[model samples]
Structure formats: structure tokens, C-alpha cells
Target chain A: MSLIPSHERPDGDPLRPIQRFCEVVTYCATLGIYAYGVDGPKVCLALPYCEDILGDADRQWINTGAITTLIDSACGSAILHALPQYEAIATLDLRVDYLRPAPAGGEMRCWAWCHRITSNVAFAQSEVYVEGIDEPVATSSASFMRLKPQKREAG
Target chain B: MIEPGHLKAEAALPPPEQFCRRIPHLQHLGMRYLPACVENHSAPVFILGFQDRLVGNTHLPALHGGAVASFMENSALLHLLMEQNGTSRLPKLIDFNIDYLRSAGPRDSFACCEVAKLGSRVVLVHIRCWQRHFDRPAALARAHYLWEPVSGNTELAEDIRP
Candidate 1:
């Protein structure tokens, strides 16, 4: 019983709204967060580092914040794989360890897995890498609090 | 009342008013400075309000998690820059750990930072984000920055040497 048809391959593009939300609200569209799909047990999303929008003051290196944002989006999207309903889930905590600064303007990709889920909490972990690069730039773990449905406001 | 060293440390620092102007990303997010008050005096309080483009979940009309995280990171970075006073190039990010206490509402959000430790080579800062009530924090973060002192700073070399 999938809450979100989009997450299940049988339902046809359940992650569409998530992708759109990433593009618009999160400013992740600038990071190129479009490519994604369910791969075996994990969900994968990939995008190149956008130097024009994601770079730092000198524009010489990728800002750590950009990498964090990418990891958050990927992790959230991965959580949606398990609970893909339209209702929003809030992130409770996020921890990212930067092993090394990512190469400036390199192609970055991420794979996320929903490791555990309970009645009200969900835990996810992910790893980010620069495309074709042997070393991963960062690793992240995040917890999401599933919120109860709220009363809708009238238009 | 402020401590003499605190005041002197602060005097060595840049005014909070100029922070938004100095960092491009903060400018991009439209973060603004708020004056000190009784509750928060450790550092200048900065704010990022609700905006259409900042919304990640249209259904819930909520802010993106990454944007909130980035805002918090910048908040800590701003505090670091103030303490460093051009002692180093932009501090390199070593790590970022964030805890979201609540679902940030669609309203103005404020951030305050506290420097846990300011060593010669590294600095650690704690930041909290709140809206409407400072008692209720929407998110909290601890960030570590690698401070690479710029060359020719005889002052810094001497301080670290002995």
C-alpha cells in the first residue's frame, strides 16, 4: 500500500511535485536537481554543481551550503520514496561531514536510503559525490518528523 | 553589562549592520540585521523572512530545509567573520550539524550565534533560528570553520608560535 503513487513505479512519476518544489522553492533547480529514480532499494538523484549560482564570493569554490542543500534535497526525496504523499514532512535534524571540499563546478550526484521508519519518525542517510570522481565529498544523515494532516484553508 | 574583553573582542569585530552588504549569498536571501535586545546579546541577530521563492513545499507553504540550513550556516559564518576581522580569507567550512526543532512557519525568522571556541586555526559556532518566539527555536546548528591565517601576519604567527 503506497501512500504516494509517484514513489512506486506502478504509479507513474510520484516524485514530480518533489522535483518541482526543489526547482522553485528550494532554489535547487539552480543546482540541477532534476535527474532521479528508484534504483533497487535506494533512490538516486544527480545534478551538476552550478558554478554560476552555487559558487562562493571568489566564485573559485563550491560553497559548503550548496552541498548541504543538495544533501538535504536528496535525503528528503529519498524519504518520500517511503512516504510520498503530498503532505509535507519536517526535517528534525541533519548532520553532514565534509571529507573534502568538492571540486569547483564538478558534476555532483547523490544516493539516499530510508534506513528506518516508525509511527512518527523517519531516518535517512545519503552520500554525495562528484561525477566520475573516486572520492565522495560528503556524507549525511537526517531525521524527518511526519506531521499529521492539517486543516486546509479555503481559497 | 559587557565584559572588558568581550567589548574589546567586539571592538575588534565588524559591525553587524554591514554583514548583509559584505556577503553575496546573504544579500541573495534578503537577510537583514536586527538590533540587540535583552534576551540575545552574545551576537547580532539576523533574519530571513517568508518569501514566495523560498517556499519548498507549496502544499504546506513551508520554507525549504536547505534554505533554512544555509541561512543558519551563514549566520555562524557572519559571526566568525566579525571575530576574525580580516585575519584570514573566507573561513573554510569543516562541518555542519543542524537540528530542526520545529517546522518553520511562514513568517520572519531570526538567527543568533555564539562562538564556542575561536582558536588560531579553527573556530566553532552555535546558531539558533526562531520565529515569533525566541524560546521556540525552529532550528539549531553547530559549524566548524578552518581559519587559515593570511601570510605576513606577524601578529598571528607570534600568537600561535608560543
Candidate 2:
């Protein structure tokens, strides 16, 4: 039924695979907040657009969903950008700290960077902030794992 | 095995079920505790009801990461109560970490869990919150609650402490 032999595996990991993974996770993450009408990775961390979701002064301190969205998007982007170097990339772990709640009715912006890539894992960090403040509303760090396709030997 | 800090009726502490009622939404979400209890000091910790409104990307607008964390932490109180039959215990949050894979749509989130370990002085719980009907979770958090034993009178005094 199969085309190739089980022992002869496929060559490398898929291209832009992280993007596909993000798309799936993005869809699943918003299941709880469907009433808000926010969807997709495109809606995440887009500066001015973030304000639309985080409206109001009193509501700002309690809105953390925006931060969650931003972190997911940033991490996705980081992994996708590194897709070419698949073997060198992986998410080891991620941690997020919410210092204070974001302002209500304003979307939060996130920017994450892959700070270090090790033999088997990658370390990444990101920050979510409101429109005005330099101080981040939330900060997160993530670890990713990398795997390489084995090269076939000449028989 | 019960921890030394486990609340016994002699401790005269509020029941975890009562505390679960304190949050009407938690009840609406159908969160239940295997064994619920209350702490003489520290934030109340318990477990989630049976169903969480938000799961997958269905309820995108309403759920907040902070709210999810609060739900997980608050539920730990119930777990404590059930463990001790409403006895006084010291509550301590060791650590909680959440991975935001995507934004949850606006829906009630559900969560369930058990105490991974309860030691002579420390209780570790692995708690998870998910929206109803969704395979993936809105968030996952694990909290370690520390219970310290004290005289019944001392427990009451601690509860009254500002």
C-alpha cells in the first residue's frame, strides 16, 4: 500500500512547517474566546489593531488573552524563520510572567527573538507591550527542539 | 496520605465546596473537586468544574490568559478542601506556567486535575483547564500548595488577619 519502503524514510522536514503548526495552534487557542471575533495569527500583535481588543482603562489590567496571542504568534514566526536550519532548531520550554494587566480595548504587540540555538534545542524570548509604555505587560521565553533527516548511505 | 497541614474539622476552616460557590462562573463551568479544602492563609486554590466554556478557538474574544491562570489557581483551593474535609492549611503557590498556543474564543472554559503529590508539608497538583468539546486546551497550569499545621485557635486568628 505504501510507495516507499519503511526503512527508507523521507528526506528533510517539510518546508515552512512551523507556519502550519502555528496555524493549527492559533485556531485551537481561540476556541474559548470565540465571542470576541478575533481569529488567526494575522490578528496577533499588529500594533494599532491590538488596541481594538484591549479597550478601556478598568478592563486593561485584566486582559491577558492579548498577551497569549502575541506570544504564540512571535514563537511561530521565530520557528518559521529558522525553518531552513531545521536540525539546529527546537523549542525546549517557554515561561511567561504577567507584571500587570493590559489596558482594556487595546491590542497588545509582541516581538520575540530566538536568542540561542543549541545542538538540539532553541531558546527564544518575547515581550508584549501596550501602545504607550516601554515596560512590557508580559514577558515570555520558549524552548524548541530540532531534528534532522538522516542521510541515506550508498548500498 | 494526608499532609500534616491537612485541614481537619478541628481546624475550623471553610469548606472548599463553599469557596467554589464563591465564584458563580466556576460553578457554571462545572468545575468539581476530588477533595476540596480551604487554607488558613494564602489564596484559595481548588480544581475546575466538569466543563470549561472555552476550548479550541471557538470563544476568541472573552477568555484572558490571566483569567485562565486565576481559574487554575482558585480551583486549587477546592482540591485542598476535599483532601482535608474542610480543615485549615497554609496555602503556597510554588509555580505556575502556561503556554499560549492560540487565543481562545469567548466561551466558558472547563478544567480538571488531581494532586500529583501530597507530602508531609507540601502538596503538588497538576491542574489543566480546557474548553468544552475541544481536544486541545485553552491552558495548562500546575500549582504546588504548601500546608502548615497550626492550633485551631491560631488558624482562626490567621483567617481573621488582614
Candidate 3:
């Protein structure tokens, strides 16, 4: 069974299906991540704070893993937005620098952009910001291995 | 629940299983603490059981990169905490760098951490993760944490103490 829904493509835009596909991802959905939209070449996503996602219960800080997940999802979506057509990609490496702790009880916004796309790899960077904070709480760089399309079986 | 003065009162650190159970995120991911006997190493090991919600790529049927990273990071943190006896405050994560050596298949993943360096105010940890075999690792990570000394009569400490 196909994971993506079969329907009319809206505005002949290639990104709509990709966006929809990202929204339904089991991991992303479980984390409460939602794609805000695409701005220029950047894709924006949001992760709302929840008790289940907290790393430090006493301090009320979001888990670094959750933040990493948000950034990874945003970076992956940015690659999809950059590509002319949808192609599978896997993360080869990801480095996250936590400038400051992300306080809980507020939504965190992430912006990612595919800085470069080589023949076999795609590089992306992302920054995460909490609402009302001017400085970014965390920043990340990631490289994804672009996979070749699979061959279809003859009818 | 762990008391605020628990670390200070005891000479030895709490067990990994007891400490990890308090972390809501680890609980959410369904991570279980495994004894050191599971691996040949002396360090404690952690297992992340496979579940549909943890899958990032439905096509490849692989675990999410973030989930794997999370497991490694948590392992490192727990290792540091377990080894660092009498540390009142939790270490702050300064940075985490991970290399995905292979795609983590949709199965139970394992992780173990080693302390590369232990300094006065900084600690560095190396983490390795594998699914099927320890020799063939799925990913490796290096994490830096800021270790703060416990200060007496500080409002921050008073506030954080439960």
C-alpha cells in the first residue's frame, strides 16, 4: 500500500504532497511537530512543549533529543523543498550545539535550509528559537545521503 | 521521587535504572536500562525498543536519526552521572556531535558510553550505538557537558532544590 494519499495535486505544486507526507510521519507526529510553511528556500517547523517531551522534570526543560528531532525533521523537509522532485534521503551526520537550555511551557520554532546539494549528498543547517527569545537556543548542521530512485517492476 | 539533597547525602551515585525512570522523555521513548553484563564493557548499557512511533523513514523502515541520537545522548548523560559521585547539580549539555555510520534498522537498538575526558568544569563522553552486533556500530557520538561546582547559600540552588 502506498503511504502517500492519492489525490489531485494542488496548484501543480510539487511540495504539497511532500508537505503532507511529512506531516503524517509517525515520529514527527508523535513529537507534535507541524510544518508552518516554506519561506523562500527555508522550511519552518514548530514543536510545542509537552510534559512527555521534557528532559528535566524539576527544571521544566525540553529534552535535547526532542530539539534534535525537531531540527532533523526540519532539515529533512528543507531538502525536500529544495529538490526539484521528491527523492529519498537519509541523515549521514548531525551536529547540534546547545547555546542555551530550551525552557518549557512555550513552543519552539525551527528554520532549516538546504545550503548545498551535491550529486550524492545534501547539506543543511537549522536554528531553533523559543517564543519571545531573541537568541537561538540551539543550532545544528547535518548532511544527508541522497538515495537513487528505485526501479519499478514491469507490468 | 529523588530528594534535592540526595546526591549530597550519599557517597555513591544512584543506580541507572532508578535515575532514568524519573526522566519523562526516556520513559516516553520506552528506553530500558540494561546491566553492564549485557555488553563486555564495564559501563552500563541502554536499550531502545522498536516501535512504530520511533520510525522516521517508513520506506526504509529505519529508526529516526533523532531517536538514535537521543538514546546515545541519554546514555552518555547517565554514564557521566553514574560515574561522577557526589555531584549535586546535573551536568549541562554544551554540544553533541554524532556520525551515522549505518542506517538503524527497525529493531531494538543498544548504546554504551565512555568518558573520553574528565576535567574540572568540563566532561567529554564518547557514545557508540549498535543494533545487531557491538562490533558493527550503527552510530558514534561525542558529547561535551559543562559541569558546575555546587555552591552553598546560592538562590539558584535553593530554587532548584525540591
Q: Could you say which candidate leads in TM-score?
A: 3
Cα lDDT tens digits, model 2, B95-150, are: 44655444445544444457777665567777666554335766666665555555
Error of 3 at A23 (Å): 2.8
Global fold similarity of model 1 (TM-score): 0.77
lDDT of 3 by residue, A45-86 (tens): 888889878887667788888898888888998988898878
Estimate TM-scores for all models.
Answer: 0.77, 0.44, 0.83
- What range of 10 consecutive residues in model 3 chain B has the weakest lDDT sum? B1-10
User: How should the candidates be ordered by lDDT, best one leading?
Assistant: 3, 1, 2
lDDT of 2 by residue, A11-101 (tens): 4423234334344443323322111111222112333343323212222342243345456456545654544443333233456666655
Over 4 Å off in model 1, which ranges?
A1-26, A29-32, A84-87, A149-155, B1-23, B35-42, B152-162
- Model 3: DockQ against the native? 0.62
Displacement of residue B120 (Cα, Å) in model 2 is 23
lDDT of candidate 3 over B19-113, digit per residue (tens):
55446787777776554443244766667778999998787789888888988888787777677552556678999999999999988777778
Return the DockQ of model 1: 0.40
C-alpha lDDT score of every prediction, in listed order: 0.69, 0.46, 0.77
Q: lDDT: which is higher, 2 or 3?
A: 3
lDDT of 1 by residue, B1-162 (tens): 222122212122223544433444565666665434423465667667677666666666777788888888877777677665644667778889999887776877778788887776777889888776677788889999877677676577457542
Top-lDDT structure, candidate number: 3
Candidate order by DockQ, decreasing, is 3, 1, 2
What docking tier does model 2 reach?
Answer: incorrect
